[model samples]
Target chain A: QQQVKQSPQSLIVQKGGISIINCAYENTAFDYFPWYQQFPGKGPALLIAIRPDVSEKKEGRFTISFNKSAKQFSLHIMDSQPGDSATYFCAASRTFGNEKLTFGTGTRLTIIP
Target chain B: DTAVSQTPKYLVTQMGNDKSIKCEQNLGHDTMYWYKQDSKKFLKIMFSYNNKELIINETVPNRFSPKSPDKAHLNLHINSLELGDSAVYFCASSRGLAGVRQETQYFGPGTRLLVL
Candidate 1:
């Protein structure tokens, strides 16, 4: 069973527009939620992360809005640029200090100029 | 300098052949992980090691084996390669586990394997 589920397998947005990706998780034990970005050939890099205690966290133009009761989280990109075209993955992990992370299916986002 | 590095960026071999991939991390991390990204771009965890010890092993095939000689290095070896095993494999390391302040994982470029 997939612990985390992401919606919109692919997305396209115009430059200067807002891009959003949604993710939902089934496990309530998950406390840490993180987002990763990957280009064509490189590895997935950390974009932004948020804990269950916070409703939202923002870093630069990237923002993660988390809803604890709903067991959902979403990533928002403000001022989407063409360079932002890439795959994004949302992951969830428990507080057991285990390095095992349950990753979502992934969302391919493209920003058209 | 690369925080995590993997050897043999690409591998192509016959179905019955065996191959090994090496991974190393210079970030002085205590945990290492192996993730397989399939054609549909689903990143799945295959194995994880902490402090030179096996921590987590997912529902993978028995033909796959992971070895950690030390905390800085992790290697994966596949025996009797199958066509279904063709995918991109990634290596990652983290100072500590998630749910902590320093739980971010650094991933290597990745190794693309194609089995015929």
Candidate 2:
């Protein structure tokens, strides 16, 4: 079973539209949640990360809405642009000592200009 | 640039062949990791090295071995590659220090391996 499950296998949005991707995790041990952006033939880059302590964390136009009670977290891109086109992955890590992260399946987001 | 880098961005070999992928990080991080991303894009951690010590070793096959020559380098060697071994391998690094819990890893471009 996948520890972290991400929704919307793929998403399409017009430029300046709001794009949202949701992820649910089964493990409550997960304390650290992070989102990664990956382009074709490139490594996934760290876009934004958050701890469950905060209900929400926003960086630039990317925001992470964390629901501790529901064990869910979502990434919201405000005013999505064509440059935001990439595969986004949500990951969870338990202890700080263990860097082994449980990554979600992945969500492909395409922004049309 | 100051980042984690891996060699042979692309590797194509036949089954039963032995190959190795080298990784180096100039970020001066104390910990390094090897991750395998399959065709389905499911990324899994295979191994991790802290400083010069072998730390996390996932339930992987014995044929796959990770060698850390020094603190700055970690190489992955595969003996008798199988079709199942075809995937994109990524090398990542992160800081390891006391009182510092969270560290975002920097990943290399990735090495695509195709086993025929």
Best by TM-score: 1
lDDT string for model 2 (B1-116, tens) is: 84888999999999999999999999889888899999988888899888878888999999999999988999999999999999999998888543357588889999999999
Q: Which ten residues in a row have the lowest lDDT in candidate 2 chain A?
A: A93-102
Worst 10 residues of 1 chain A by lDDT: A92-101
lDDT of 1 by residue, A23-82 (tens): 999988788899999999999999999988889999999999999999999999999999
- For model 1, the stretches where C-alpha displacement exceeds 4 angstroms are B97-102
Question: Per-residue CA lDDT of candidate 1, range B1-116, in tens?
Answer: 98899999999999999999999999999899999999999999999998888888999999999999999999999999999999999999998744455388899999999999
lDDT of 2: 0.91
DockQ value of candidate 2: 0.58
User: Which segments of candidate 2 are over 4 A away from where they belong?
Assistant: B97-100
Task: After the best TM-score superposition of candidate 1, give how far the Cα of residue B113 lies from its true spot, in angstroms.
Answer: 0.2
Q: What is the interface RMSD of each candidate, in Å?
A: 2.8, 2.2
